[model samples]
Target chain A: MEFILENILNLIGFIVGLTIGILSYIGFKNTGSPTLFRLGIAFLSISVGFFVVWAGYMAEDFVLQKGHIEKWVQTLGIGIQTIGYFFIAFSHSIKSFFPKSRYLRSVGMLPLFLVSAVHIEHILRSVSFILLAYGAIETILSYFEGKKKGTIFVALGLSFLAFGEFLGWYSFVFPESILYYVSISIKIAGLISLFIPISKIPLTKIKFDSEF
Target chain B: MSKINAEARMVTTYRPHMKIIGDILSTTRDDLHSDGGASVTYLIRKANVSHTRISKILSNLVSQGLLEQVNSEGTFRYKISSNGREFLVAYQTFSRFAENFGLVI
Candidate 1:
């Protein structure tokens, strides 16, 4: 199980990187319009960032094996993860905060920075979990607001992520290595979140049209 | 209350090619215009529309007098009015513009 998990993360990281690459191409193809062009760049940024995390994680692991190299790798991992988070969050919607940009469609990178910091810093993990908890609750609320499908699934998924982060962080506090698996599980969600939808949209759309 | 409304909303995001819309609306109008009027069921069957969508379209047509409701005992009969004919013609013209521009419906 340990070997499998370790190897698969690397493979999935490549796949995720590929998906983002596809997204970038699609964005560019549609780039006659500014909106799509910006979106393409954002997706590319995120893909590049994820690749960094994949590389940083491996580097940090190697460093941990050496008595003298521990602190540097941890710092490097933290930096890469932080930058990756920035790109991920920036790729999502965040424009509502600015009045002018409210209509412009916001793409803020702030949460990426925040969560990346929280994850590596340990002290801020509680705060990160709290923010995610709030997000999970809001996702539930959105389900009640006329969203016809996937509302519950999304809510449950987000809850899982929140719990995973919270529990992993708790384990980190006590220096229990077992909880690292839980933390790894939380990150692995990108595999499900990123790839499953790309595969299932066709099936879901078919069922949707036939039944509804 | 209408399935068609739900379907319409579903497809609102689809952005179909103008040619497809023209094909669909032409077939629908052909089936509806034959007798100078159409029952909702006949239109639904011909247009491949569900009851809900028929009701939504009828409601709009009635509001604009493009369709008139012939109220009968226990059942309402829907008939295409002159206003509807005009709207159909206008929609056809719009389809032409869409095709020329390579735009989606």
Candidate 2:
């Protein structure tokens, strides 16, 4: 029962992230907004990350009796998701920050490769939470600066995502607790809130029509 | 080098022509919604494009049913059609989405 619930929740996150990613990509194509492209990459990375973790668990439980590969897979997923969130947090500055040394950007993944030790999982989770928190704060600050409609929902969504990560980190420290389910639910709600504003974007209907 | 890049970026900020058309159409819609209609000169000023570009954009928008052409006192003006208004609404929604991510559209 627990396994089923976990897979189902991850599946939901994957679908939501995929949908938002595609929509933002379309927006990027239409508007040529660099930020939209970063947003697309962020959501798609998260979607892939969730899928990797889910698939890893399934493979470990069903096929590979390997003792600890599942944890490594989860770590890798978190690492990919962190990269996505970092791009989102620094959408505007990233281009200028690494104008000359493009390869240096891959250095961010160093922590993931080194995080195989059991105790290091908690540290990785904390780092992921911090990245998410930074992104949320940036969104909230943008909202305050613009005061645009629907931005509040975006800010709210990022807050919930950060909060959910915090809870997940706490649950990891004290296993077999209610925080696990609560964190999953909060993260799901965050994805939904982030989706609320973009749900009405007219991707298919944006093309110009023939006149009367 | 940075200065040159910044100058180039400023020039190409609204590039590839399509986005400029959308911006002008949407701006024209805003003018129509608030002031009932707008002239080519008004669109040029509001859309921050050159006279030739705004003229071309207005013609394209009219052909696409996004704007209705109006002629008064031998001068051509334009009003937002229903479709144009809908486009503006959708564009606003898209802009808001992008803005939430700190992207200026």
Candidate 3:
């Protein structure tokens, strides 16, 4: 029963991320905004990562008994997702300063290197939390500067995601607690928050001329 | 942070020409409409650009049938054409999409 619930949650997260990814991609294509393109890449990575995690979970529950491949699949998913969050943070807070710096972008992969450690999952979760927290802080700072409604939602969504990941990491210390369920629930809420704004983008009214 | 990962680096910061053209047209149309018609000086202020840049963009807009030049009360002013109005609406929709990502279009 719990396995089914986890898979359902992962599916929902994947769908939400995919929706956001497509919206950002369309925006990037229309406006040619590098920021939007980065955001699109981030969300797409998240979607793909979640899909891999879902597959890994299914395999773990149904198939192989503790194989190296299955474990690495889960680790890679988390690593990719962490890279996505890192891009979100960089795009939001530091892109303008180092717009096309190859050097700066390399910092995003530091978490991937840590996957060789014994507690790879915990390390990935902690790194993801940090990246997400950075993004949330940047969004909040932007909200304060502009006082826009959209900014507020983005900030709240990213913050919730960070908090959820933190709780997931905490669950490692207290395996018998309900923190796992709570973490999944909160992460679902975070995905919803991120999904809501982009959901209506496709229906946006435009009066384009035949020439355009 | 010291050693850059070769595969993770962003190579370019290029924005498509169409986007730039849309930005110029939308800014011009919105500025003129809001002001009921505006002088070059007003456009420069509204677009946050230099006078020369505004002049070049306005000429391009006028040539593209997106703007009309008017001589009113001994002052040259610019106004949005019907085509420009439609373009503005399309640009606005694009802006809203970008806004979802907390990006300024």
Chain B TM-scores across candidates = 0.61, 0.69, 0.61
Off by over 4 Å in 2: A65-69, A92-120, A202-204, A208-212, B1-23, B28-44, B48-93, B100-102
Q: Supply the TM-score for candidate 3.
A: 0.72
Q: Quick one: best lDDT, which candidate?
A: 3
lDDT of 2 by residue, A1-212 (tens): 44766677678768878988877776666555666788889889888888887888789778996743477788887777776667666764544434266466568556666765647657766676766777777767767767865677777887888898899889977788989888878987887887787775555556533320
- Comparing 1 and 2 on TM-score, the stronger one: 2
User: Mind giving the per-residue lDDT tens digits that candidate 1 earns over A88-121?
Assistant: 2233233322346644434444555655755454
User: What C-alpha lDDT does candidate 2 achieve relative to the native structure?
Assistant: 0.73
Q: Write model 1 residue lDDT over B1-105, tens digit each, in one string.
A: 699988887767543332332333454456554444456666666655568756776676578675677765556666656545544554453332222112222
DockQ of each: 0.04, 0.26, 0.27
Listed in order, each prediction's TM-score against the native is 0.43, 0.65, 0.72
By TM-score, who's the top model here?
3
Model 1, position B6: C-alpha lDDT score: 80
Q: Rate the local accuracy (lDDT) of all candidates.
A: 0.47, 0.73, 0.73
Interface RMSD of 1: 14.4
What is the CAPRI rating of model 1's predicted complex? incorrect
Clashing pairs in 1: A85-A112, A90-A109, A95-A106, B2-B52, B4-B53, B66-B84
Q: State the lDDT of candidate 2 residue by residue for B3-70, as single tens digits.
A: 99989978776443645766777777554554447888888877788887677778878998888988
Over A1-212, each residue of candidate 3 has an lDDT whose tens digit, in order, gives 54665677679878987877776676665445677788888988888888888988878867875532376887898888887887787776655533376776677566567565748778889979988988888778767756767777777888899999999899978985899888888888888888766666644465433333
